[model samples]
Target: MNLSQNLIHEIKSLIAKAKEGAIRSVDHHRTVMYWHIGERIFNEEQQGKNRADYGNYLIKYLSEQLQPEYGSAFSYRQLELMRQFYRTFPIANSLRSQLSWTHYRLLLRIDNEDKREYYIAETVKNNWSVRQMERQINSQLFERLLLSNDKESILAVARNEVIPTNPNEIIKDPLVLEFLGLKRESAYYEKDFEQAIITNLQDFLLELGNGFSFVARQKRIHLDGDEFFIDLIFYNRLLQCFVLFEIKTHKLTHEDLGQLQMYVNYYDRVEKVAHEKPTIGVLLCADKNDAVVKYSLPENNNSILASQYQLYLPTEEQLLKEIRREIEILNKNDE
Candidate 1:
């Protein structure tokens, strides 16, 4: 580029960076301001601790006094949120500057301390936007991860204390695909579903978990004049392996697992380097039977997995049921 063009580009980049930095600075201060407000309110409430309703009365009174002057930002509800925020995260230094007030507001909804910590670590680690974090929470990402993995290991991975070695550690089962805008009632061909994933690739990646980069769609291979195509391929930097996906619009069967296994074997033999791990084969089916999945693969098999996919986000009832079922399976295994 010419000197003038280069100068203009440099100026634009500088201004953009400055604007982003300023926005971050403002957000950080606002978050700190709310924490202080919460702390002060808590201190005042402690003085009147003898009265059962003093905390409520204090917040209501403060809201009335501040609302008119500060507008609805100081509403009684918002103040209560601030108070709860402080109670939840008492250590001021523990608050992450990378998170904004909105992020904290969403987090404040979670009552489970362990769940809260996991989300906090994941949000910061992934640099999730407020909306992305909300979607993840709504989809019950933490609960889903807990289905196959233990809580301690999950938290350890989220906190970066140890790298994820197993595919199940990072891959979520029953992948929620509400963002694809595909109707649950509508019948979609495998090609159409694949196309939708590509169209909404960004959201797909977030839902897929961390360290995944899209490689190819309908990745073709040949074995002695017989050709095959894999639906989707992704390389996970964290796992240091290729993740091959086969989309099954219908219920999963042993045949589906066998097909994906063949593809995984091909990648491992031909594409995987010496330093890389074995390729993981995932059958992204619309439905699955856990028993069939279990018996289809060898008892020691670790590379092939069957994960069901839902076109819509699961409701709270569904999430609770799934969690209960997963817990039951774990309990049965222990016996």
Candidate 2:
């Protein structure tokens, strides 16, 4: 018996499809296996009256016995992580095969149930990678949201698919730049910092918060045979607007605000679609003068914001002072 050329081709295609399916099935099974392992470890730890000490001893003994045979996967750290995996997601049925164990590891660190749930929803909704998820968690996305809105509103936005409409809803005031690894006392130029941000663009985007998708760096614009370039361009799906950012190393100036306004105008008129909301322009600077910002921008300004970026994390005392100042200002306004 001889096979026809068409039959051979069809058989090859079927074999390829079968192989692909098998690979997918294997991955699915692996994920399930890890989840079950985590679940079993969790239950055993709970059964022990002294769960914490028991867990520690279990991991230590398990690693001593299993590491030689099973390799690094069965080590103390890995077993501890597996135990945490079960604790984080106690309900076995709730485990999602689409998400990797790494994703759950990050979620386990978040102690707040509502916050963890919000991240879970946002991660799945945005299709964020594990790195992105970790970045968001580290940046304290939940705390930032809490500061901006009431509990009801925050939970509503998280549970439902409702995207934030206002800039304040998502934007962090003192944007952290520790990821850039710049020294506080280092006399680096604005261009140097901006370039570093460009180099670490993916991390920068994650730091920028949710809904931001990078569009361009130093994006060129041409008008009347003259050319201008915007420092950074991004689209925020949650805000339904284009976000334009300008970097400044020195204290923010009126000129900087004016320049950002111009960029915002250009984006609104030339770049933004009719269905989209107004374009937002952010001036990322080392320091900002509140009076200068108030005087430069319009009273009802919502499209433009001046945010100070810190190379290093500020001390708790400094943060407390800032909070106190904000409270004072709010009190005065109420008066």
Candidate 3:
């Protein structure tokens, strides 16, 4: 706390700040530069559109011409990526400074416009690093959300343009727990799984999606003469409600739904304030029967839901197939 020590600490802090600022500046500049290169190459390719060999040799020739002076960053593969980046985000001004060239490189892999845009908006809003963005996309976070929602609402939430009001908006079905390092084939207790989630709380929150804050684990609640414990408690700011979760290591049943419903009622009556929304309860289990779920809850009930949990990441092909199937269903419903 001496004056000299204080000065040293202040100078060190300033130096760290400057270094971070410089790194960010460099990343932003690199991104903008790549965008310009992509723009130039795209224009050149358009001009050569009439030629048969135009598109085939454009990147290779460009790489040969530019790599010598510009270095490895202009390799044929990198050039193609740049072209893809430009194609994904045509307007240079639409690119975000918060994202780097690495981020866009991963995003360019996504061919679906809505999914790509959703990832971009979520990345910026969540301030996800390139690695985080990659993990989310690989885990099919958008598709998982789509499992519970239709296209319009899911896309709106992805864009961060609309705040979610209902519990369905924020809750994802079949929560991916690969980050927990749990084995799908092995038997595990709910307590062990909950502990794993607590250990990787950051990833859990990310998986939970926007506006969730962890409250407690095995949160204690007491009634007239008995004690009750909620497995996990989270508050969603967007819904302005408490999201109480009951962890089940087995198949979801009417009993499981009833327990969660009781928890939801307790939270709504005891924990929630007058102005706040009703508490939402989620029964996260190994499996769920849709018909059972429909019969377990009231006909118009939206407060309680049951979702399955997958210990491993679903393959891209699997997710795409599921997405296509769901879209077809939605289209049929529309008609």
Candidate 4:
């Protein structure tokens, strides 16, 4: 590039950054203003507790007085939301400046304090946009991560209280792929699925969890004149390991696990340096037999994992059922 072109690029970058900063400043102030409104409303309601339906009356009255002046932003519904926002995050200092009011609005939908805290930590840590956080919440990302992980440990990792040492800590089972836009009824080959992932690589990385970076596609390995191709590979900085993914368009079998395990071994032995952790292999299949997966790997196996993939998001009922089933399986194992 010529000097003029380089100068122009630098100027554009600077302007873009300045605009982004200005937008963030506006959002932060908006969030703070809403919090103060909520706090005032809550205090006023408390003082009028003897009146019947006082809280509702107060909010409704406030909405009436403020709406004409402030517009729909202070409507009854919005005022109620602001009231709940203050109740949810009682301490103003605890509010995250990186998150806008929309982010907190989405978080208010979650009733569980632990779950809400986990999402807050993740949103701030990952710097997720409002839409990205919404998708994660709708996909029940927290509940999905709990499938093979303990709640406390998962929260700890999200809060950065502890670093993830194992794949189960960060990698979710039954990965959601609704963002890929693949129809559930349509048949797709492994190559097609891999191609779709590549096309929506950014969303895929988000679903893959933290610290993931793309490495290769159809990465070839030759062993004793035999050529083999791994579907996709990623590096996770948090785990400090290479993650190998083998896409299976059908139900996972013992052979598939064996193949992924071999790729993981190859990566650990050939690709990884001494300071890095062991390579983790995952079988991304359309369906999976958990019993088969259990018997395929050793009891202490931590590196090799299998995750079923779905083209569509699961309903809340379906997610609850899956979680219950996983819990039952864990209980049976203990027994």
1-335 per-residue lDDT for model 2 (tens digits):
89899999999999999997786577657656766777777677678856559867766887899899989988888888777776677777887655666777778777888888888877876678887787677666666555445556766676665668889776777887888989988899877887899888877877776778988888998878989888888899888999998988899999999988988998889988889999999999989998999999899999998888877655546665666677777789899
Pairs of colliding residues, candidate 2? none
Best by lDDT: 1
TM-score for every candidate vs. truth? Answer: 0.96, 0.73, 0.90, 0.95
Residue-wise C-alpha lDDT for candidate 3, range 215-255, written one tens digit per residue: 99998888888898999999988999888889998988898
lDDT of 4 at 174: 82
Candidate 2 whole-model C-alpha lDDT, 0 to 1: 0.80
Alpha-carbon shift of residue 267 in model 2 (angstroms):
3.9
- For model 1, state the Cα shift of residue 156 in Å: 0.3
Which wins on TM-score, candidate 2 or candidate 3? 3
Per-residue lDDT of model 4, residues 1-335, tens digit only: 45798889999999999999999999999998999999999999889889979999888898899899989999999999988999999999998989999999999999999999999999999999999999999999988888788899989999899998988888888899999988989987889889999999999999998999999999999999999999999999999999999999998999999989899989998999999999999999888887899999999998998888978877888888988998898899799
TM-score winner between 1 and 2, please give it. 1
Better of 3 and 4 by TM-score: 4
Give Cα-based local distance difference scores for all models. 0.93, 0.80, 0.88, 0.92
List where candidate 2 sits over 4 angstroms from the true fold: 1-72, 75-81, 150-160, 215-229, 269-273, 313-335
